[model samples]
Target: MAKSKKKQQTGPDIRAFFDSMDALASEKGLGKDEIMEIFRGSLITSYQRKYGPDARIEVTLDSETPAIGVSVHKQIVEEVEDPSLEITVAEAKKHREDAAAGEELVIEEEPFAFSRIGATNVRHIFFQRLKEQEREIIYNEFSHKEGELITGQFLRWRDREVVYVDLGRAEGVLPRREQIPRERFHPGDRIKAVIKSVELRREKSRDPGPYILLSRAAPEFVRRLFEQEIPEIYDGVVEIMDIVRDAGFRSKLLVRSNRSDVDPVGACVGIKGVRIQSIVRELGNERIDIVNYSPEPAELIANAISPARVAEVRADSGTKEALVLVPDDQLRLAQGPDNKNVKLAARLTGFRLIVKSLTQFGEEMSSPEARAQLEQLFSPKTEEGAGEDGDYTPLTELPGLSGRLISLLEQSGVKSVEDLVELEPEELEALEGIGKTTATQILKILEDVVSFEEV
Candidate 1:
């Protein structure tokens, strides 16, 4: 009767272990069924190692009480060649008279108390199995999140080469190459990055942890950030048309509004620059230009050179080239420091932009001798129209001549058709916006318009 009473108490202790597991599952946001599955496998391994491979083990959680049950399997045989695999037939008959040879039987025994070494081994196996299962859960949870932005706390450096981030359920890695150059990370700092990839290593020798790769240097990172901060973008009212980046230095994004009422640039910039500022802060304060996308090449080129006021945009659609004219005083601003503005604008628009000052245009337009040569080439057939106005007024009437170019000709002192005929194509190409092809085109046009009589 005392043994019976002691066995009753052991059941309660076993039940308590299951209760603890349930509480842990609830606290950690893990499923109870998953925890139980892992617990079962751990117990089987531990029991087999401690006792024998054929040791009977049945694991169950008490619903009314918090406890677990582990039953060992014992078999009866005529002779015991393997003690772990069989028991004496006579002894088995004492417990079960119906037991026979080759008949395996399960024996319910009181929960065995583990020794110090056994207990430690059980714990190590349990936790190791639990961690592996948890890693699998985390990988499954986050594998679908590629190309999405996730926020995490900065953890520690690995191999002094990779930055580790503490995601809620798993650790994520931001390799040195994936990080923006010159960016620093410290423990406990909150950061955001895009999930680049997730690798699962299931080898028996490996730790079984997921290889999570993250990135902050990708252009898609910027796009995803805007999608988060800008409501219009998330709702699909605005679309990012193109992205041109210089990595850490700067990026230009071209966005267009899907709805007529929506202002794409204004939406991305947000009120008081709040939306883009959030992104800028994350990217180590990289400069960003949010330009409104335009279907017209001329308008798009003008927008691409933002902060540089453009007087006019003359585009050669055939050659995909544009000449942007700015005021004389704005030339420095148009070109930016070391011509950064023009360089970025060219990348953004995918066009060769020649930024010229208004002064340069005036010089190309106002040459008097150049005008006389043009007038003689297209001479007035009627005497009635001939007058002291040199029979030709504004040079802009020519197909390729803009008002700015006419002003440029006059400024250079080429006052008549004779002087224009003498000018060389190489001299014309030296102008800021005029390339070799444009210079050749202009020379051909001038030659066709100027007559020898006018010269």
Candidate 2:
């Protein structure tokens, strides 16, 4: 009578227990079946620790309803060999009517009969497994977001070197080296950064999930911000060729328009500088320059060094070097704060840019060596071979080229056979007066005199 009363008393509590488990599984984004399986294993461990390791125990859980059942299975023998695993026939008959020799008798166990220590062990196992499962879920979810922009709230600082941001399910780590120099953040402040890496750490001392390392200083961070803020770049009307940055100071982007009507720089800057201003505020007022991209090295260098208008750009194709001439009054602006403007421009254009004022260039031009070089450059060449071997032939002497084509080539700085051979077909076609048909004719005529492979 007393056992029947106890069973009735605990029935509601068992149902409530399973109900809470279901709620927790749903809230954690874990499978209900997996959660139940983890608890079942925990129960098994508790039972084995109390009643010899070899004791047979079975745990059953219902999928359709919140119900749990546990049972103990022991073999019936004439005499018990192991008290925990085997039972005598007389004792087994009390639980089962069909108890016999060499047969197993099943006895249902109470929902839980855990001692204090056993209960603690079960709770530890359950939570440890649950936490590990949750960590795995978080790791898998965030791994795909590497190199993407994410907005998170600042949580706190660790060791005065690492900044922690609450990314909802996971915490993002912003190391000191990855942060923009001198940038400050307060708790609960919203911050934006690019996911630099996702790493899974297995050390026992650390948290289980993969570490999401974030960065605000990386060039890619600025690239993602441009993509998000600029409608033309997002929709493919304008393309970003490259980006260079000195974080917290300045960043330069090389952009080009696929359509002739849309100016890449104007689109990025927006009407009265609204769109770019929003990005600037987000970056803590870092200077951003939008430079137009050009295939011509001289034009590209001139465009890259901005804010201080370049008077002229002189480039050497062989050495990949460029000299940028700016107005004497704008020399300080061309160098920028800490000379970062010219440095970033050089990186963006892939040229070693030497910036000089018009006055400085004039002074250099007055030198005897510079004058001699200039004279050699402008002087008309006689019908003389270019190299010592005397095998060099001039482009005018080559057949199949029209007089007009030769004049256009010379006007665009392709004077000799050596200069003509260096230009690709697309580059020739890009010349001011050159057409696709003319470019094709030029390549064919050059092929007859010089084997491109030998050159």
Point to the candidate with the largest TM-score: 2
lDDT tens per residue, model 2, 1-455: 00111122246667778788899999988888889888998888777776668888888776445456667778889987797798888887777666688887776766566677877898998988788788878888998889999999999988888999999999999999899988889977999999999877774745445689999999899889988999899999999888998889988889999999999999999989998998888778999899999889999888888877989888876556677888988888888864668778888887766678888779879899877754544344455633412333467787888889889998998877756765657789999799898888888888776643111
Residue 408's C-alpha lDDT in candidate 2? 93
Indicate the TM-score of model 1: 0.60
Q: How many backbone clashes does candidate 1 have?
A: 43
The most accurate candidate by lDDT is 2
| Tens-digit lDDT string for candidate 1 (1-455) | 00111233246655667678889788766898877777778777787875588766676545565445665566667898776667777766765677777677665444356678877877888788777777777889889998899999999987877898998878898998889889888877997999999978775733356878899988888989899988999999999988876668777899999999988989898889987887898888988989898889999999988876889988765445677888877888777654667777887888767677877766655898755653453453446755435533445545776666666676776544434544556667776666687778777877677543211
Every model: Cα RMSD to truth:
15.5, 15.2
Steric clashes per prediction: 43, 0
Q: Lowest summed lDDT over 10 consecutive residues: which window, candidate 2?
A: 1-10
Candidate 2 is scored at a TM of: 0.69
Runs in model 1 deviating more than 4 A are 1-12, 47-57, 63-67, 72-98, 109-118, 157-161, 185-188, 201-208, 270-275, 296-302, 305-455
